[model samples]
Target: MTASPRTPSAAPKTDTTDATDTTEPAAGTGRKPPRRRKRAALLTMAAVVVAAGTSLAVTRPWNTDHDAVQSGPRDTTTKVERTSLSSGMKISGRLSYDAPTDVIAQGQGMITWLPAPGDTINAGGKLYETDGESVVMFTGGRPLWRELAAGVSNGPDVKQLERNLVVLGYAKGLGLTVDEKFTAATATAVKRWQKATGLTQTGRVPLGRVVMLPQRTVRVQEVPGKLGSAAAVNTVVKVSGTALVAIVQPGEDQLSQFGPGRQVTIRLNGGAEIPGKVRSMTPGSGGNGGDEGIQDKPTVTITLADQDAARTAGQSSVTVTLIGTTVDDALVVPVTALLALDGGGYGVEVVTDGTTRLVRVELGLIANAKVQVTGDIREGDTVVIPE
Candidate 1:
């Protein structure tokens, strides 16, 4: 007999039965589906889904296609080279005496006589007269702060006294050990020093009895103490080096570019260029000791490598050129060739054998319209630049 076609209403019950057959039983029931799906069928479904997605993405059938826009030859180009690059700034300076150093009084007495401003005081010589007595300078590694007499504490002050006595010819037969401790021989040497300096011959060396300096001699700049004034721990005189120096007041940022012994070119106001080196630097308010921040540049003292040239140049305003930054044997290109990359940072467009590529580079100092670069670039490589 022929079977009658199933009515549409039977479809719902058939679908429900098929769904129940496919679904697994609830948890803890331990009941599995009536029929297991074929492993090949599940794998095939997953692969087909992935393939369909990939095809849609690759084809993008709904979108319209346009002609590719080709990049033409650059309007300008440059060759990368290995060379030294540096950034520099021209700084104004002047040939002037360094700041006056205060000759502070070390002892207490009446100021009897002062040295003339133009006088020069040598080491181991008298600095000034106090109450008709000389406050003499003696060679000492340390400054004398207390009485160098017997029963005094052992310190460098006592050693300085003993050394001074030996040099001054007081310890002839005493055989004093120039150590940091006081001995009877040291006291005897002090007595001899007191007698020579026209004192009461007390076997005690008092503080402020002498002034010590690192140099051999100093040119007297000024004598501020007046005759008959009480000699205390005040600045008695002002002095400076006899040699001329170029003073450069560079701002804080530029100071980093300079250091002791760095070479420099000094252009005097009278139109002369001299080779010099940075001798020293003092960080503070350059003038008047005001509250001017970095604007008040530190005073940099530059000494001419040639002493005769410095003397000839004389004291005047000058311009100094200092080396600020330097990179040697570096890959470099024109500043214009540096390009802002689409992702970030910087890059250059390199043209090699008619083929063009973008190369990222690390940038360094920019000097004289050229920039230092490093990276996938090589020397003699042609790079594209804007006109």
Candidate 2:
């Protein structure tokens, strides 16, 4: 025989009892009614802690059914204005070069010469001399890792060296083409360059004998190496780009509000404000990379359109305010002008020549305690608020 299906019963309802339960008053002594006690119990439920251990009773202020009061002739009002409304955040940043290049040593010799701080090193210029052999700067995007000579493997480094040689006036009549192959003509040009820089004329370019930098010119910031120190693959000097920039380290949350070409205002240490735009943004893991001094945060680079203004605020801590979410030609009013309508929205009391009427509005961004609104609002329209 088949069994009959059992009917499922409804789940029991749960009652969330209040923390301060209402109780009936005792008879006599003109005690308050249960309604007042229930109301008091509800208000007690909204008690707020004013300090560490003290509590105070609080009441709700948003009442939709409240009566609208009439304003006297002396009541003050605010006029709605049309302007740009924006919301954003401000962060602290440093004004410096846009990723300065650290010059590390690769030659194996004593540091006999070091460039002074604030010196400008250009292409074909001597960065430092090791054991009386000058390590000359060259224009290239690749770092020199191996010796470039005849019989070496063909690669892009050979072409880069050839380009440098051409600019150094060494590849005039050697009939050499700027390519990946290491040719005998390239060796001849190397010999000419060696002779010009007082290096031994070996017709070969040794690793660490030339410093290849991506930029043509670099302004030296500091010489970390002391004269007569052993030259190794260590940071000897720090060089920065000629152009200055403001770098801000923001997290992923703040990065979402940023992009390329956004306008920003930088407040300098000396209380000067300058305008700039977002140049670039690099996402990072906020890694310390074994450096305790540097906070591992994502970086944002900003470049000022006015170069002269940047010169005045060199290498200092500044406050960076990123402007985000801008609405142009917007009708705005004070936030106090908003009132809860009887049904379900917000409205502002529009005051014309001698009459006042509540006009419903569509709200937009709220900035600086002012709200952007639309719908039946015009510039110079007077709006009423609580006196």
Candidate 3:
């Protein structure tokens, strides 16, 4: 049969050519155009060449060889022998304690003399009472004239302050009250005591606070209240001796890597290191109201595992080291051997064939200036140790 003659539809009528073009595709659109595989291959090859050239251009060494990696300082000294080691932490710490001494009042009152110089009081022993109010709230005990004393301390505040002075190793008599006057000696003692307790060194008792008891040896005999001073009830006194001392409060940073039954080294302020061990770690915060008036810092009390002859309670400072981190057979390197990088951990420059190579390292326990490292370097391999 003959097909009827068909005429093409009139050119699509549209307001805009762009719109008409969007409505339909061109003729021959049913079959895809021939693919230009060779052209694509050429473009891809050109891109790969450009990328490779760019990479070569940016690389530090144009012709990298083993020599480039060998340009660091060579090790003349034998590499430290390898030893068994595990990860641990190290820090600088000051020895401290939360002692069980009788918290004394600065008066010659009854409870002042209860605990003898060598007496071992209970952790919560009731040695003295701060009757009427907390020392932190003392307001010159209702006498406005006391302020005119020019930094003078008196009343219950005087007794409390004086008692603190005695406990701080001040030789002032148990009846030694600073009167309504502030003495130079009194001020000096107060400042020293403040420094030791990590308190502000203002001579006056800030809101009338108690000073920390002296380090082990020094003791507070008594806080002398002014004789016949018309003050609220009799003033209280404190007596603390320097015998049988132990560091009760060791800082959190100190105990971070240490565990129980570890040996400890105690280095007292102006004294030498005395061998000791981790006696026990008391878990609790002193609620001490810290150096600032916020809550007391959370603290751990670590007593001496071994006796420290050089210990002095209430001393200004001491250094402590916990023993658990010690590595008897660990591969240790000088800290100077490692160079700090942007990220955590350190790197060492290994000396090989009169050149240096940087080797990345993972650190283990740290003691003194030496650290344990795990890396490509092996035992007997010499590395540059910075002077």
Candidate 4:
């Protein structure tokens, strides 16, 4: 037999109850709750929803609303000011003497004496002893290739010898003219120089009697021959200019960025920094075999402004920083003040009075944790940063 569908009955009505009420209806009681209690419960829930929305509005991060003003301490702020900014490129280098040249022995004699490394030799100074005779130092561009005597052909080497004699005060009364000719007066001057230098007065300059270099003073860098060794036609001593210079090999693409007289900074191994300038640049020997795609590197020489300070480091590796393009009298700010906007580009928060607003800026040279900024930003304006 099929069952008949029962009719649904309406729910019992009662007055509204307060949401805070914890009382329950008595067992077997037919009485319904008042409608006021139900209304009160809904009103309480609505109040809670409104309270949560108010909290979110007050605690939002980085409020963009222009009408709102920030309050409390102002420690997270910085000022924009006019300053100079430049980019730098650091290269590894070594501190050492300049123009290292080999002093080769040109005579067939036994080495009697050799100067210790680091010894300074000036014009008219004894470089080393050969067969009980001293080989002197002379300032000239070319070495003495042939024996200089009264019968030798005129050449620049003879003039170099005559000039050295005049500088050493040996040609004061000889009336010797400094020319490419080895005249009789030059022989007399040579004799006087030989007598004063404790050598035989033969009035003739033999090959290997003097070591001609371009500098007025030279520092001995190495002594390759021993005291008792034969002074063969080989490098007896290595010498260099007295001044110290930093040598660096940078890529060929950076050749135009460096030149003579450009200012630079040198950081020594001891963490001390000193000022320097570019002294010279030499093009590198390019080849096709080595690194296929890489170009040859050029050599750069830097001279320190403070020679006394540089001497303290001796021979050691250092860092050479080359200053690149510079922006002078530019509006600058700390790098931390920059903010990346959701839309493309960058901006900084400008704090005026107690309010903050984003000001778009165009970036320039970034150096030393500071950046150059432009576009509507003025010097002395305060900018905000995150703490």
Candidate No. with top TM-score:
2
- Every model's TM-score: 0.57, 0.70, 0.37, 0.67
In the range 1-387, model 1's lDDT, one tens digit per residue, is 001111111111111110112344558856532221111111232243232221111110111111111235467777899998665557787776554577788778899988998687776677888988888776544566765567888887776667778877888999889898888888888888778777778887777776666555677878998899887888888877677788887766566667799888887766778888888898865565455452455778888766566667766777887745577897888756755432223456677666555554555555666667766778998877744
Off by over 4 Å in 3: 1-224, 229-235, 240-243, 248-262, 277-295, 305-308, 311-316, 328-331, 334-349, 355-370, 373-387
Task: For candidate 2, give the lDDT of residue 281.
Answer: 87
Q: Which should have the higher TM-score, number 3 or number 4?
A: 4
Could you tell me the lDDT of residue 343 within candidate 2? 26
- Tell me the lDDT of model 1 at 174: 94
Model 2, runs deviating above 4 Å: 1-89, 267-275, 289-295, 321-331, 340-342, 348-359, 374-387
Q: What is the lDDT of candidate 2?
A: 0.70
- Global lDDT for candidate 1? 0.64
Candidate 1 regions with alpha-carbon error over 4 angstroms: 1-87, 96-100, 139-142, 167-173, 191-200, 269-272, 285-288, 291-296, 312-315, 323-387
* Full candidate order by TM-score, most accurate first: 2, 4, 1, 3
Per-residue lDDT tens digits of candidate 4, residues 188-212?
9999999999999999988998989
lDDT of 3 by residue, 296-321 (tens): 43343345533345444344455665
Highest lDDT: give the candidate number: 4
lDDT of 2 by residue, 145-222 (tens): 898899999999999999999987899988989999999899999999889889999998888899888888888888
- Pairs in steric clash, model 1: 106-208, 107-208
Clashes of 3: 36
